[model samples]
Target: MFAMLRYAPLLAIPAFSSVAWAPPMIRMVLLMAVAWLTVIAAPSLTPMPYWSDGGGLLLACSSELLIGMTFGLAIMLPQAGIGMAASVADMQAGLSAASLLDPGGQHEPETLLGSLLLLAAVVLFFTLNLHVQLFHLMAESLRVLPLGAVGLRLDPEAFMAMVGSSFLLGLMVVAPLMIGLFAVDLAVAYATRSMPQANVYFLALPLKIAAALLLLAATLAYVPALIERVFQDALARLPSVFGA
Candidate 1:
């Protein structure tokens, strides 16, 4: 039990960071405590494979920790990639200038699009009951990959596929805004070409901003569906992470 407790922090770190509403420290503590209690009480509620001695017990605990960390990483990687890609897109779109630091992400510059993605992720997790599903999955994984068994193995190809999917999702989410901004730019260019005396840069800036805002407002309705798909994909790919 003490050994499992030591590994609880590893399990908590990724799950806690993924949640947007909870303070980082509080999330971490909550998840760690949950993991600790789950492991400590496992023997009483379920049949645990018997070990011969202290040496066997030590090996079992170490293996459990490794498996927990691997499971946590599988969930965290996609979210981290999505957040990073969203930040890049926001920077390219000139939206990074007015970013606030995000405490959950270690004070990184939190761009508008990044914040939206994070919020969407959080909403989908709760609304779809993904939090409950994820906890159930974690418990099931323990049965399949028991203590003293080999640690869960990640498949590189599948992981890369998920990463690609996450990037594509991010692009799709921001595509409407980009397209609107591009149209505004083209219109401004045409106006400048027809009337060479005009100051196109100054005139186009507000137009671009207004167009972006309008498009964003219009696209708000589709956001819930997009978020649901992303969360579904995240959950669907869980088995692949453990090479299942």
Candidate 2:
């Protein structure tokens, strides 16, 4: 419970285990279930000697907390790239000013395209059963980096590469939309140049929105592939978070 609570917000990025509006009891039940399942998977595992000492127990708890945070952040990076792409798309489409209904039932308004992308991404995530793979990774973490175990190993280069890839993901996903919108803006400028007295803002707004929607409609067929690639790459790198 403490471990998961440490990075619950990060986990929400991919909707791995977050049910933001669900009752607290349900959330606790879920954490309990996962814990139970982990133990069941490694029935021979036992508490570390640190459990008998207050200071060692604290250190163990801290390690568990760090473990959850590291994993949660690992999941968030690639998905956050998808989210960043949605924000960029909204801005390029001139839809940044429009608010979308909170599809997660948070009842808060978000960027229009962001909401759609997040909803679609979450649906695709579960459809691909990446959640199951992540669940398996969780179990693997226990065998590889059990609670309170000292002498943790890490690769700073791998983590830095993960960070760099996240930004790259955003760029790749939003590139098409950005290019289409730029062309639209250029054409709209040329068309309106002769009529400086005319209200070009009103005219160009609708054109940009239409072109944006059309471009997205045409290119959306590739989104699932993009998402799958991003997550698979992230998952492959995740083991480095807990080991060398």
Taking the tens digit of each residue's C-alpha lDDT, what string does model 1 give over 12-71? 444523453457677667766776766665554333454556676667676666666554
Best by lDDT: 2
Model 1 TM-score relative to the real fold: 0.73
Which residue pairs show collisions in model 1?
A: none
Which segments of model 1 are wrong by more than 4 Å?
1-11, 14-16, 19-29, 40-66, 81-85, 99-108, 195-198
Query: What would you estimate as the lDDT of candidate 2?
Result: 0.70
TM-score for predicted model 2 compared with the true structure: 0.84
Instruction: Score each candidate by Cα lDDT.
Output: 0.64, 0.70
Model 2 per-residue lDDT tens digits across residues 185-213: 88778878978888887788988899888
RMSD from true fold, candidate 1:
4.6
The TM-scores of all predictions, comma-separated, are 0.73, 0.84
